[model samples]
Target: MEASKVIHAIYTDDDVLMSAVKTVKAEKYHIEEIYTPFPVHGLDKAMGLAPTRLAITAFLYGCVGITVATVMMNFIMIQDWPQDIGGKPSFSYLENMPAFVPIMFELTVFFAAHLMVITFYLRSRMWPFKKAENPDPRTTDDHFLMEIAVHNNEESLTNLLKNTGAVEINIVNKDEDAH
Candidate 1:
């Protein structure tokens, strides 16, 4: 059986799309998704999406990278192979920390960036070479598509979308993995 019917409301401009989202939200309609050619600032907040925890995870990843760099540097330069800097030997890890600063900083940035990308992909359920959940191809080029589920109020939702300056509105059966 079909999952349910959904409305695909297309807009030509980002501003119009944002306003339409607000209007639909004001009408208490649940927005399944919004597709755009590029990022639309504040759209997630407008859609009432909770703030992401990715930043926190990135910070934690950075700390891990720094910790690994510290341990590796300590073992290599201080414990195993001692080096002389200026007039002091690498017996003290703290004293030799300046030389390892570059490695620590690089590892921190590296972990934060790479791990954040992977986390984002996993959280969003986006995978390379996977079938895209996008309903309209125009959303990839120049249009914005707002998908809203119909809860026995298709007529009201249709009229609401029409009033919100939607250029094209289509009613489509929900795809199995469109969510």
Candidate 2:
């Protein structure tokens, strides 16, 4: 496959980056991605990105955790080896639910957190020992980088990005075979 050229517009401040994103969107240029030192409020809205479904996934994971905890506790306390403690016989899970509340809560949070992290990693195409895809290291520290595909309008795009307060701009040719 042929290589494609892309523009990397680097901004020092997130506010400038956010405004640039709005301007770029208004001009109908497709923004490939944006990198930032930290989370920028409203950046996703400015970039017109779809709302995330991670919250829904987290809720489902929490429900699964709760169910697992309930079933495991029921089997252990009621069916497998029933023990009488505090004068309360472990004969039914429903009656002993109050005692298992802390365990249930912990497992729910644990599943939600761990599963969400794994989901995020997989969704982002990240894994252990994978090479970093960041174009610039400064973006991880103090800069914001916006990537726009160069669609035979380099001069116009460069001018627009400059006007939008880009501190540095670079054109990179990405080869499909480079990876």
Candidate 3:
């Protein structure tokens, strides 16, 4: 298959980049990706991306953590070795739930946080010792890079980006394996 061509429009300021994104979308152009030095508020809305569902996954992870804590505490304290502390020889999980409240809360938080991090890393295709996929290193410091897929309308796209205050514009054939 032929390699796809993309236009990289570099902007110094994020405000200009935001305006340019709106204009590009208004023109019915497909934006491949955008890299910014810092988080740009409402950029996802401008790009028309759906909201992330990580929060739901985190809730599920927290639930699992709670279940595991409850089961483990019941088996270890009530079933395995029932201790008679404070004149209470009750071998019941319900009776000892109050003592396990802190453990349950801590495990829930720990599972949600750690699992969310792992999920994000896997979903983003970021693994240990993986090479960076950034097209320009300047984007990490002070520049914002906007990548737009070219569909044989390079001139018009270039003109539109130039008018939208792009500091530099470059057209290059995108590598299929790079993504």
Candidate 4:
């Protein structure tokens, strides 16, 4: 795995952070990550991140879930158990479908929710019982931070960050405490 030499910079407000991000992008600097206490509007565009396809993935998975539930319910209730046990008509599958709808709906929801959760975890590089990788504890509180990893040049990077209106800057190592 490639290691990053990160410079952690803190800003007081989201607007200031947004300005810094815009300046960094305009200068063509590769930003590793930005940490904020809450969602910052237009931050994704400033970072030049591609739009997420999670909604599309979720929709496709939900369709698969519905299809599976429909097929399974039809096979078991119509083909396998042909007897009209609960005063249901045995000849018509569509007519009796309303009665089997609850189970089918429940199964579809179950499959879709589980599959979507798994997809999210895998895409975010998170797994069961995995350790969290939060760099600064203050970021979760009131601070907004930006991290940039430079390639063999520190002075120019620092100057660029200062010009971008960073309030405070610190060099961070991977093993150090987050605070």
Clashes of each: 0, 0, 0, 0
TM-score ranking, high to low:
3, 2, 1, 4
For residue 170, what is the lDDT in candidate 2? 94
lDDT of 4 by residue, 7-80 (tens): 88888889989999998888888889999999999999989999989888877877888788888878887888
Q: Please give the ranking of all candidate structures by lDDT, highest first, separated by commas.
A: 3, 2, 1, 4
Could you estimate the TM-score for every candidate? 0.93, 0.95, 0.95, 0.81
Residue lDDT tens for model 2, 90-122: 868988999999999999999999999999999
Query: 1-179 in candidate 1: lDDT tens per residue?
Result: 65788889999999999999999899888999899999999999999999989999999999988998899999998998886767776768998788789999999999889999999999889998888777888999999999898878989999999999999998888865456
Query: Candidate 1, which segments miss by more than 4 Å at Cα?
Result: 85-88, 176-179
Best of the candidates, lDDT: 3
Better of 3 and 4 by TM-score: 3
The RMSD (Cα, Å) of candidate 4 is: 3.2
Candidate 4 deviant stretches above 4 angstroms:
1-4, 83-87, 98-106, 173-179
